[model samples]
Target: MRSCIWKSLTLTIGFSQNLWAQSIHLNEVSSLASGAGIASKPLLLMMGLVALSLLPFVGMMVTSFVKMAVVLSITRQAIGMQQAPPNTVITGLSILLTVYVMHPVGLDVYRKSERYMNYRSSEFFDKANVDMLLKAVQVSEEPIKHFLKTQASEKNLQMFYRIAQKIRKAEDRPSLSMNDYIILVPAFVITELTKAFQIGFMIFLPFMVIDMAVSNILMALGMQMLAPTMISLPFKLLLFVMVDGWHLISKGLVLGYPL
Candidate 1:
């Protein structure tokens, strides 16, 4: 009886010791995981902050802001009102117009990046969510790519393709596709610039005629000392107001993009 009791006690003690060892190991793992998680959070936050800072510039490249701003600036120049609306006003107006035009694209991106949209900004300190954030970014970029591709001219795209081919190794050069932003972005920008200039030229024509007509009248009036621009400015403003120039320009710009 005594020997049996001794063996049973020994077995119980051995089992308890094994359980204690396992508990200690689990605690160590938990502490290490928490430590690593804590350490990584600040790094993620810094990267996020950097990305936020760069987002506006990225926005300018990918959105209608480039074309809108250029056209608006040229319009202001055409009106001979260099600073009448002010630079801040022009930039703000351009941004508002860009947002208006790009709202559908934004919605599409948000829908496609549902994971990102669902991500709680309140969880800013969470390190594990970084991978999800990156995945969201990748998915979100697709819609912007679509927008750029739709607006980008094929000839301009080919031009950038040739340039990119020259820039990279023969083996590294990828085929020109909307999927590649490196080739697509410059092409989209140049295309926007070309279209903006074309619009600007049309805007200039009416104003140019006004200036010339005013110049001839002044010359016949023996008023060479007075600038034609000064005399024509009031008449130009009157003509623009009569035809609702702002409304027409805004309508044309909004309508220019394929629905």
Candidate 2:
């Protein structure tokens, strides 16, 4: 009788487990059937959030953000600040300036998008988008062309014009297209980089003089062990402040670009 009771108890536990497993399987099957017919709202929302997260990065790459940020960052570094003004501050300033520079182009894009969404007008959307982008490219192109004319040789111009001509021929157009805009972006970027370096060299000269003078004075005064950087930093800051260096730099940068 004892053995039979133990056997019955074991059988009961096993049966319960099997029933539970079957119920779980049924639940999974039901879920699959329901999921097959419709997308979950949560999933759509998650995807939208992911796309939104990437929007800033896309804007940085495709707009004036990259050039502005790079130039400002380089200028900060050249000043020998070594994160003195802070990366966040530099980036924030760059963003504000980029917004100012790109405002008109952005307005054009926004107007076009609004018209398309409100009127279901594909033609207007296409026309507006293309025209806005072209205008932006044209604006950006002027600065780049100016830089190239000053820095690059005639041979470089020939090569660039050849590429532009090829692009025009491929599109069977006498004017630039969106694809041409792609080529112009990198060309413009290179031009900006070159100009930034040139400007950085000029900016570094005064600081370098201060550094050398401080180092020589420290050594001559039998204080060779003193760090020149610590001694020179204050003077550099004072000079920068007195001369309104920030204003001069910002004005030069803003004016350097062709309208």
Candidate 3:
């Protein structure tokens, strides 16, 4: 009687387990069907948040941010005061300057995307079309691509285009046209870096002259053990301030862009 009762209990438990598994499997299938029929709101919002988080990185890569940040950092180094303005201060200034230079481009992108933004706000997930997202991206990328193309030199474009042809498969190579973002972004980056270095070199010149002059005076006075930077730093700062360095730099950067 005990064995028979135990056997009956085991069968009941097995049946319950099978039923539970079937329900779970059916629920999963239904969820997939529902997901296919309508886009998920929470998922879209999460993706949008992620995209927003990456905006700074994207700005640094494609905009004048790289050039502004690099030049400003190099200028600080040239001044020989490692912690005076501070890295945070330098970065903040660079970001602000970049925004100033790219304001027109930003306005254009916003204008192009206003309709989509309004639609998303009004309907949220109800009107969310995957095509709308694609359209928004496609529309936004055009102004940025145009800005990059304007900044990137012909030689830089040719170099990347040639490299793309070599590495990509023949069938894919045809699609990788001269105007493709893959070719354009790297070229634009290199161009920005080149311009930054060119500006940095100019920034270095006056400070470097001051250093050499200080070093010579120290040598002549037989104080060779003293560092030139210790004397030249104050002079560099004075000169920079007298000339209103920030205003001049901001002006040049704004004017340099073809916008």
Candidate 4:
């Protein structure tokens, strides 16, 4: 998970390189031949720090984290569990499952950018070379981009692409291509959310039936004063345990992502 998060940060840096370029003065580099050595390094470090600050948001959106987290939360609710697993446990399990699924993509990013990552301090930092950083980020981002493209639904992609075109001015519309990360990320998120809800609906069925049965039994017994939830909770828990729900849920969520 850490690896994937860091790799995603590199992609964020790549996306913001133009902004970084704008912040630096080109005349300073022209005036002082060693300006890159003195000035560029600190600016790059600051930008990297900013990228780190956005890590959590980027990490959650691009990975299987959202789908896993949402599905787990839905599972807890369906089981009539208000707090037994706790929010923390659900979040931790989702993150771990995301890590398991994304580990390969992280490794791919590392392998692709290994040469830039392992540069001698003198080569990478001693000189002011923003191109090297840009190239590294670009190389690192491809695997993640491919992952998003694969998981994102074509219907959502087309929807977002059309929306992006509609929002942009005619000339700018041509610049906003279908493959852009700006378009892909939102589409990917919507796709994941749609899948999570579909899975949640399936999970809710049996438990819903249990609740209905308990409620009807109470009605037949003329026990309207008693809460049906109190009666149904144990049966829901029993059914969950009997089917080994946790194992099945974990397996399905982990396998849902393309590793």
State which candidate, 1 or 2, has the greater lDDT: 1
TM per candidate: 0.80, 0.58, 0.79, 0.85
Q: What is candidate 3's lDDT per residue for 1-259, written digit by digit as tens?
A: 5332222222222222222442444233223333332345455455345545555556577678899989988888998989878889988988888878888887776676555544432332233433443345546656767888889999999999999799867776666667666677789999999999999999899989999999999999999899889988899999999999888887898789866
Q: Listing every candidate in turn, what is its Cα RMSD in Å to the true structure after a full C-alpha superposition? A: 17.7, 20.6, 16.3, 3.9
Name the top lDDT candidate: 4
Residue 122, model 1: Cα distance from true site in angstroms: 7.1
Instruction: Point out where model 1 deviates above 4 Å.
Output: 1-45, 120-125, 174-178
Model 2: lowest-lDDT 10 consecutive positions: 6-15
Give residue 159's error in model 2 in angstroms. 5.9
Model 1 C-alpha lDDT versus the unseen true structure: 0.68
**Cα deviation in Å at residue 230, candidate 2?**
0.9
Q: List the residue pairs that clash in candidate 4.
A: none
How far is 188's C-alpha from truth in model 1 (Å)? 0.6
Show the lowest summed lDDT stretch of 10 residues, model 1: 6-15
Model 2 compared with the native: what TM-score?
0.58
By TM-score, the candidates rank as: 4, 1, 3, 2
